[model samples]
Target chain A: MSGSLQTLSDFLQCLIVGLRLGSVYALVALGYTMVYGIIRLINFAHGDFIMVGGYTLFFTIPAMLAVNDKLPIWLAVIVAIAVCALVGVTVELVAYRPVRKKGTNMTALITAIAMSLFLENLAQAIPAIGPNYKIMRRMFSNKAVLNFLNISLDWTTLLTILIGASVMIGLQLFVKKTKLGRAMRAVSEDKQASVLVGINVNRTIIITFAIGSGLAAVAALMYFAQYSTIMTTSGTMLGLKAFVAAVLGGIGIIPGAMLGGLVIGLVESFTTGYISSSLADAFVFLILIIVLIIKPAGILGKNVGEKV
Target chain B: MMNKNTKLKGYLVNTVALAVLLMAFLILNANFKTPFYSVVFIPSLWQISYLIILAASLNLVLGFLGQLSLGHCGFMAIGAYTAALLSLYFERAGIFTDKKAPVFIVSILVSLLAGGLLAAIVGIIVGIPALRLKGDYLAIITLGFGMIICNVINNLPFAGMEGLSKGSAAASLYKTGLGFGNTLKTKYAWVAIVITILCLAAMFMFIRSRFGRAIESIRDDEIAASASGINVSLYKVGTFVYSAFFAGIAGGLFACCNSSLSTASFAFTNGSILNSTFIVVMVVVGGMGSLTGSMLSAVLMFLLNYVIKNVIKASGMPLFVQNLFKYPMLVYAIVLIIVIMFKPKGILGTREFSLVNTIEYIKGKLGKKAVKEGGSK
Candidate 1:
């Protein structure tokens, strides 16, 4: 009985970690799915926005913490989100807008890839941000608030889940009740029709990018807090995983992204615990391939047959 | 009969142009023992050939079939490892021991074929399910496949091993013994050049055949092509397999010439020859569906990379300037964006350059000048 209980506790512990990781993936995946919904193009650089946000915090948090040891998490979160949104909007306007106007889908796709490469290489080349890891300062103590039957719940884990749930609920309400959210939905459904009906399609798209990027910023903070390190290329793998999560949940669906993120996180955690940690990535990709093959529309995505 | 005659003439012109170019290089390599030729030009020649093969193969899928696959490097890595393992096995079996030159040539041939075949098999397996999807989904799936391949290779115990030890920890197990250290001390420039030309000819012929027309029709309109009874799925899978085959052969050549084989070499990161972005950039800049354009851009990009690296090394520039020059990918990204924005169709834009076209262009220019003079008179 004791052995079984211990095993149960271990499993539950893994679940808690999975949930924490899933929330971060959910936040980033929301950005990917939203941008993809609004524009048919996959914003390849969306992943890089997380990296940008990470670097923003990497630069800001240490200096602020040095000046005042009691810096609020909210202040850091707001500043990072603002900077990330600014960068996201700038990228959409400067790099993506012109290409979107005068090119095919292939061209736009290539441009997005180019933008990804440009951002990554530029970060590496900059003297201040050379290819090195920056250790992120801790914002809160990871002290256990609850312990029951050999299972402990930490403060950081609680905060991650609470923030994630609140943001998700808030987003759900915004999309359902707000005028801007309605405009976004209308534009995604039919851009021409939405424009005809007096929705600012471009503005809606920009706001979508802002919201997505801001969420990515939050994800970046949580990720850094957990990992305690930030690198120029850290976002690549995380972004890819979140993308898989989004696709697994049925892309362009909000709740689906959340569910998918959690599922992927659980799968990864279980694989790492049971199987070889190194092969965990391979398994994740294999799952992605299988999911794509079996249900290309994803779990919650509607299958729209091609019109002849 | 006239068409046949023109075709024959076209072949003759192309052969002569190729011969002249090869002869120039051979003469320079034979006589000019300068550091410039040996250190830079020769290596750059082989690298250019590799890139051309990669770009042309990817063009068949991306440009001709209208499918985006971002995992060409995965196939290349497959080929590289296959070739490396085969050569090592042959060396262990003691087949090519006495006569070094013949053995080297035979091993290279075998590795290329074996590597290409294996890669094609993997390609077909990946393509069957992946091809059912469209656009960005296909791209992501393919990217996932590439990463899977990289991780698998990194984790696999090298050459002779008992069991799969964890991830990249197994990298320490294998020894890459194929290239410069063991082989005959001769430049591989000529071999790469010949192989590149043959691959180009094969791709060109395939593109102009009836099957090529079907592929192009599918690209133009999938529904129309399907209506015309074209087996869309078969053609898509076939194109992908063919592309992977060539990519594998290129990988074999790269493994043989460069001699260093690491999983990182095949990753989708900056500065790796096996990177998908670099290959896509080559095809895009060269003009999609134009073999000549891909070839031209491949050579041009190689030269640009070489120049940037060398110039940075030679110049006494500021630290910041030198730092910028250290990453050629930054320049490549800028160029890619500019190309996509301004000339989305690329430098050639589905147009091929030929000796006949060049002659006709010159004659047309002369005729126009003559007409202008007559009008003036």
Candidate 2:
């Protein structure tokens, strides 16, 4: 390949990696934005749900694969999603419900932080799941399916992007076309109004958490597959980055999360590829700070003034 | 009449109480042979003092300023690394000549001040843009700033190279010591305790000052405060800088006490003093905006942590059961969650405990009873 072609391919490879990473971020960010939109509380433990999902797959996949070598990847994913959704609902109902009822934002935020800490410590305390990082069993063969001009694309990356796109589109359709989606939008816009209009507000909120957490599980599967290591505290940074993506995308807007995730993922990949890899995290945060300063409402977020 | 005389009396009483407490700590430090003093009291005292500085500094932002800053630990890290590195350099340079006592005191004081000043400068840089964002947005931005700070420290060639090979091009400037020497010995726990008391007093006085009132007004309502000519932006930035300054000092003291500094010590991960959530938990549990509450809660929480960990270690239990004790943070998390859920306003609910208030309350109750008795007669 020519030098220019090499450079182009390198850029394209980075772009591909960025999209794959961005999709996972987008999945997590969707949950974050949705929760923030409805409850005005950042469920800091939402990221821990991803960790739980990974662990679920870690434990279940190995056992099932041993019994039947031909076990489908989707079964493990389905099981993980179910487990994560249940965990999400329990967290919402138990730790978050009372704090939200109290209607104190600081309290709610602190409670969320506590939940994050609790989950992390609990995981660390558990036998065989201590503080050490565990290598994930590769469920999918990450073979390159396409190669052109010195650039190769892996099947996992393609599937990740494809799945991410499909999920985003599916979420968009679900929110736009379904009755529950309308209720979710209504509750997010005005809880009291939604309640008055005969919408089961509590049920809708639980469903939102379930859906968001299910997406997190999917994100976790993709994340562990890519990185192939799981730590109790891994979700903390991932969650923070996803939260930033949500905010970057103009939090509370669905499309914005997707866009923000892509931007963050791209920035991170380019920084790691072109600049110092050590500075990638710093660059990501710097971008967040700059984006927040330039557009406090986020890239796609509408600026709303606080009323007296 | 409740006037300057009463205020002066309150100050005098508080000073006397502080002096007595200092003397007690000095006596304890001098008598290092007692297992109770060495193992339980000294460690807990130093931790309490460190926490007081952290919790109180965070309160200035969370409570008085009504701005949530999740990156307080970032400032603390700046302080820790700066102080640790400087003290290490000074020790290596043989700056402390024969006069051990005075030199040690002066070096520690200088390193701490330098740490605080550097951290305050960073705070100003961070706070300028960060303070512009409100509420949760501000919290997340501060958090990002904190993670960025940690990442920088972890990757920087100047630090975090304790384990790396020397021949490598990225070798650090200073050798990462296993621990600080006699310079930061546990005997200096009294010094930390005294500094903590002074910081608490300063914060208490600042909150009562005109500037503090201006800051509080801004917290109450920024639009109204600005309308009332209280430069909201200036106060917001000023308060953040002030808070960061103290948090930096606390970090300095922490480095001195622990005698080691690393990016791991300052990151927002599990078991780090720089864990933003843990600091926030301390502030909230102490009751935001109340110095007394912060101090009391800090002491209580530190004791709880120390006692629980020690007890678990000493207990004659199975390996599995004993292993569960390794997660003291789980207890902290549970306590924090309970506090948030049951008593969101915190134990003191922004109310400071004062001798004057206690005296007045007793007097009022006695007078009311006397009046009631007389009426019945």
Candidate 3:
């Protein structure tokens, strides 16, 4: 019984990890869900954009280090986030805008896939950035900062959760109050109708891409902060997980993306801790399949009547 | 039956092209020890052949049948593992000890059948649930299934035996009834290539049948086809099965070529992603529903990769140039984006290379009055 209790404690510790991890997923998922809501095109390159964000941080941090080793962590993170937001906007303008104008669904999907491949290849081709770059190892890579009685937690974990929560809250306010958010919502409802109502669909899409990419930027920073070393392929698995989170929470529903991310994170952590690390993903995917079958509109998603 | 003029032209073209390529290979081979021919030619042959099979099969689903799937690698993994075990087992069993069973030919046939069978089964299961869904919804479900399969395979005990890590030296109970014995493991490259070609041939035949036309109709517009009395669900399942079957065969061929099986290899890693992306690109760049286009694109992609890998290396470029080859997903990602933006329908765009279509054009030019009369009715 004591042994089982110990395992339970370990499982709880993993839950904390899962929650932190889920926060990142939520952030990234927001980008996928938001863009999908408005454009109805799944931005496959969203993950690669996250990779670009991480790489940008990787390079930017070094330049900052050239001036001084003690670059304020918060400042470094902000700069990374800003750069990622710009990259996201650029991706939308360069890769998506043209296809959106044509308005064929297949073109966007294929374009997304192609853009993803292009970004990945471009990253690979860049000097000093290849398959694996062990950006300076830090003492804090795996070190936990705080402990709740017996549950140890890391600074990165806390930051991930905090940033995720704040971003979601920020997005909620932005969507509900801000003019651009209204424009975004209008566009998401119907692009043609919104344009007829005097909205600039192109501008709204750019903003959507900016916000989505900005969230991915936050996600990249947290991801790198937690792991320290980032590989070219890091964005892929995480991106898929975030996509799952978005779907789980009811894709296109802002709050749903957040809820979904946290839930997926907890499930992964608990499963890995209680059963085996190997089964965590299997369990998460199982949940996805079940959720999809039960509620295709997603947990928070509204069911729009099927078009005739 | 061969027309003398066309046959002569064909031979002349093949001869000149081969001669030129051979000269180029030799020259490149001679200088800077180019490593170009050594690296490019052989790998290109193998890679192009594989892509041809993959892209061609995928076209059956995506272009001809208008269905999409992301769990393709799962079928492939199953096919590969099946072939690997079969070949490895037979060799160990002394069935080919005294004289090696033509492992290449026999194993390929076994792998193809096994791949087709396994893929067909999974196709039925997936297609049944997906029948009601359309477009993006179906895409998500298929993507979910792909992820699930990858995770389960990665997490599951390799064939239900615990602690039996891949390539581990320990004796496994599931080893075919063949006693553990010394066996020769040769590079299965030829085996993989031959199987890929054979599968492509079979697929070409299969698609040209009455069934192929039905699939084309379904792809053009499912509702219209169904109203014309086609069973939509049945055709969807059938097309999916055909696609998966080939994907499975490709997977089996991969296992033989790679000589190792790990969940990671087939996971949606950059390598598998590249394979899938290239297949999609090939289908698109070549033209949707055009077998010739798909094959040409497959060859083109292989050549592109070869050029990128070798030209970058031979030029004595920085170390990062080599790393670029190592991370091809980025390249694939970029290509897909570009293709989508510039040429969405791909190269062939539902058109095939038909001499008859060309002849009809020439005949119309020669007899404009006759052509107009035919249309006037």
Candidate lDDT values, in order: 0.82, 0.84, 0.70
Q: After superposition, how far is residue A183 of candidate 1 from its true place, in Å?
A: 0.7
User: Comparing candidate 1 with candidate 2, which one achieves the higher DockQ?
Assistant: 1
Candidate 1 at B3: error in angstroms?
2.7
Error of 2 at A285 (Å): 0.4
Residue-wise C-alpha lDDT for candidate 2, range B4-41, written one tens digit per residue: 99889999988888789778867766765666666656
- The better candidate by lDDT, 1 or 3, is 1
lDDT tens digits, residue span A145-259, model 2: 9888877888889888999999999999999999999999999999999989999999999999999999999999889888889999888889989998998888888899999
- Positional deviation of A300 in candidate 1, in angstroms? 1.3
Instruction: Give the CA lDDT, 0 to 100, for residue B121 in model 3.
Output: 81
lDDT by residue (tens digit), candidate 1, B162-240: 2212213434222333564322223556777888888889888888888888999999999999999999999999989
Report the lDDT of model 1 for residue A5: 95
> For candidate 3, lDDT tens digit of each residue in A1-308?
37877777777788788888888888999999998888888888889878888887777776777788876644565776787778778878777888877636766777777777677667766768865666733423456787654778777677678877888898999999999999999998887899898999888888888889878888888787877777776788888888888888887778888888988988888888777786787788778777777777778877777443
Candidate 2 regions with alpha-carbon error over 4 angstroms: B97-99, B162-184, B272-274, B316-326, B359-377
TM per prediction: 0.94, 0.93, 0.82
Candidate 3's residue-wise lDDT over B1-377, tens digit each? 54777756654654565467656744543452334443545445554665677788888887788776666666665665565566556656665553244644564466457756776687777777765566666666676666666556555555323322244322223333111121221233344445665676577667777888888888888778888999988888888877878877766555544434555555554554334444555676787778878887877776666565556666777787676655555555555566666777777777766444566678878799877888999
